[model samples]
Structure formats: C-alpha cells, structure tokens
Target: MRTIAALELADCRRIAAAAEAMAAQHQASVSLAICDGGGHPLLVVRLDGASPSSTAVAMAKARMAALNGKPTADQEAAINGPRPALLQLAGVFKEGAVAMGGGLPLLHSDTCIGGVGISGMTPELDGAIAAAAAAALQGQPG
Candidate 1:
C-alpha cells in the first residue's frame, strides 16, 4: 500500500490558530474546519458569535477541498459551469461536499495532504482565511 501523508495535531493547531488570527484581524466571527486528505475531519473551531450553520458548512467545504484537491470555489465554478448536473449529483456522490468558496487543500511536497475551510464571513474573506491556514503548512513535513 502506498503511504499517504497526514496532518499532525500540532499542524492542526497551527492551522486553526492562523485562521483564528485572520478572523480576528478582520473582526469577524467564523468557523473553521480541517480535514485529512481522506476527507476525515481533524479539527473544527466555531468562534464566538459565529452562526450555527457555519460549522456544518465549514466541514463540508473542507471535505470538498480535501477530496477534490482544489479550492471549493473552483469546484463550485466547475460544477455550475460545464457540469451543472454535477451539482445535483454532489448530494448523492459526495456527502457534505459543498461547492462554495473558503476551502483550501493543504500541500506537502506538492501533494495534497489535507484541507482547511472557513465560514461565517463573505466567501472571499472565508477563502482568504482558509488560504492563510493552508499557507501555514507550507514547507512543513507531513
């Protein structure tokens, strides 16, 4: 069997902290989620005053990025563009796979090792925060 890199607890904490810092910088309440490459959740944080729905959306976005190996917004565009039908299929094919923005895959050695998702803000801002979290993992071993 081939070995797959995974995020450690420390890495998860770092990603969460980075995302939280970004949220604070913007004075936004948000929810963040991190998942392994297999789309299994590793960590989730719902900041104070964030909407309750954000937690679920955050996890869905993380799963979408982790499994698809791309940002959730890109996936959303693809599905809504050439393959509009895929949007319907997403429900049955990929449970908890959202097409919205704010999800970023974490890479190690150019390979996707995990993903981070942020919610409770505009899609652009959420994506930015997730990107920041992913960047924190840059140059780090899996």
Candidate 2:
C-alpha cells in the first residue's frame, strides 16, 4: 500500500484562520469551509454580516473541490464555455459541485488532501479568501 499525508485538526484551524484573515483584509464578510480528502467537513466559519445562505453554499463548494481535486472555478468555466450540458449533472454527484469561483483544492505532494471554499462576498473576494486558505495548507511544514 502507498502512503500519503492528510490534514490534521491543526491544519484545519490554520486554514480557517488564513481564510478569515484574508476576508478581513478586504473588509469582506463571508462563509469559509474546509473539508477532508473524502469531502467530509473539517471547519466552517460564517463571518459577521454574511448572508445566511452562504453556509450551505460554502460547504457544497468545499465538498465539490475536495471530491474533484481541483478548483471549482474550472468547472464553472467549462460549463459557461462549451459544456452547458454539465449543469444537468450537478445533482447526480454526492457533493453538489457548484460552478463558482471560490473553491480551491488542497494538494500535498501532488496528492489531494482536501479543499477550501469561501462565499457571501463577491466572487473575487471569495476566491481570494479560498486561495489564501489553500496557501496556508501549502505553508505547513512537512
């Protein structure tokens, strides 16, 4: 059997803190979510002033990224470009892959470990925060 690294609880806390710091930097209120390799939730934070609906949306985005092992924005672009038919398949997946610009996959040594997602602010800000969270994972010392 092969061995791979997985995110620990401390890693999740670091990711959440990174995401929150990025959101605060932009004065944006958003929902942040982190998930395990299997798309299981690890941490979720809904900042003050964020929309109530953002919680579930953020979770779905995180799960989508974790399951797909890629950024959710890629799917968004594909569906918006020349694969609109993909929209019909969203409900078919266990984790609803939202075609948005705020979800990022967590990869370590080329192995996907989990995902980070942010919502409630503009897509730009959400994406920024998610990216920050992913960076935190990368910055972790092995």
Candidate 3:
C-alpha cells in the first residue's frame, strides 16, 4: 500500500499561534497562512488592522514556498526586471504567487513538509516575522 501525509490540524494551529505571537511581538499586524506540501492553503489568519488584500498575498507566498521548497528570498533575485522568467515557472506567478520575502518553508526532520506566509507590513518586516516563526519550529518534536 502507498502512503501519503498531510498537514495535521494541530500543526496548522501551532503555526498560527507561533506566527501571531511573533508578529505581535514585533508590533506588526500580519496576515498569516499555512499550506500543505501541495501548496494548498490549510489555514489563514489576518490580525486586526491587517489589510484585507494581505490575506491573498499571504496565501500566494505560502504556495510559492510549498511548491519550491525554498525560501522566497531565493526567488527574489530571479523575479526582478523585464527579462524575468519567474512568471513562466509552473504557471504559478499568474495566480499571484509572490516569490519575495515574507514566505518560508516549514520542515520536519529535514523534510520540507509545508510552508508559511506572512504579510501586512513592509516586506522586510513580513519576512522577519515569518522567519521568526519558522525558526521557532526548528528542533521541535513531532
């Protein structure tokens, strides 16, 4: 028999709590999103004062990270300027998958099993909050 894994409810909730805590510590309202390994959103939260549009952006960021299994920072260099090919890689860009800061891959035992996206602040701030949450999950027991 074949087996596959999916993001658990507890995992989603943990991520949301951690992300919200980090963003609040930074004094930034944020839109947080969690997606499964397939880049489909499992959970989303927009803190008070977060822009409504930030929700979509957060989802896109999570999708990008889940699909790529790499930090969105790496994609930033490729998406700049007129000759960028970022839009042609897997038909994701057209759907608003932003390959920039604020998105990070979530891992378990060195396996990238999901991703988190954060928005509603400066790109740097967004990235910082996301990184904080992602980093906090490191070395956590399953």
Q: Each prediction's TM-score against the native?
A: 0.90, 0.92, 0.85
Ranking by lDDT: 1, 2, 3
Candidate 1 lDDT for residue 78 = 82
Q: Where is model 1 more than 4 Å wrong at Cα? A: 92-94, 139-142
Model 2 C-alpha lDDT per residue in residues 100-131, reported as the tens digit of each score: 88998999999998988898988777888898
Per-residue lDDT of model 1, residues 105-129, tens digit only: 8888778998898999999999889
Question: All predictions: root-mean-square deviation over Cα?
Answer: 2.6, 2.3, 3.0
Clashes of each: 0, 0, 0
Indicate which candidate wins on lDDT: 1
Can you give the lDDT of residue 87 in candidate 2?
Answer: 72
* Model 3 regions more than 4 Å off: 1-5, 81-83, 90-94, 139-142
Screening candidate 3 with a backbone cut-off below 3 angstroms (N, C-alpha, C), the clashing residue pairs are none
Pairs with steric clashes in candidate 1: none
Alpha carbon lDDT at 48, candidate 1: 98
Clashing pairs in 2: none
Better of 1 and 3 by TM-score: 1
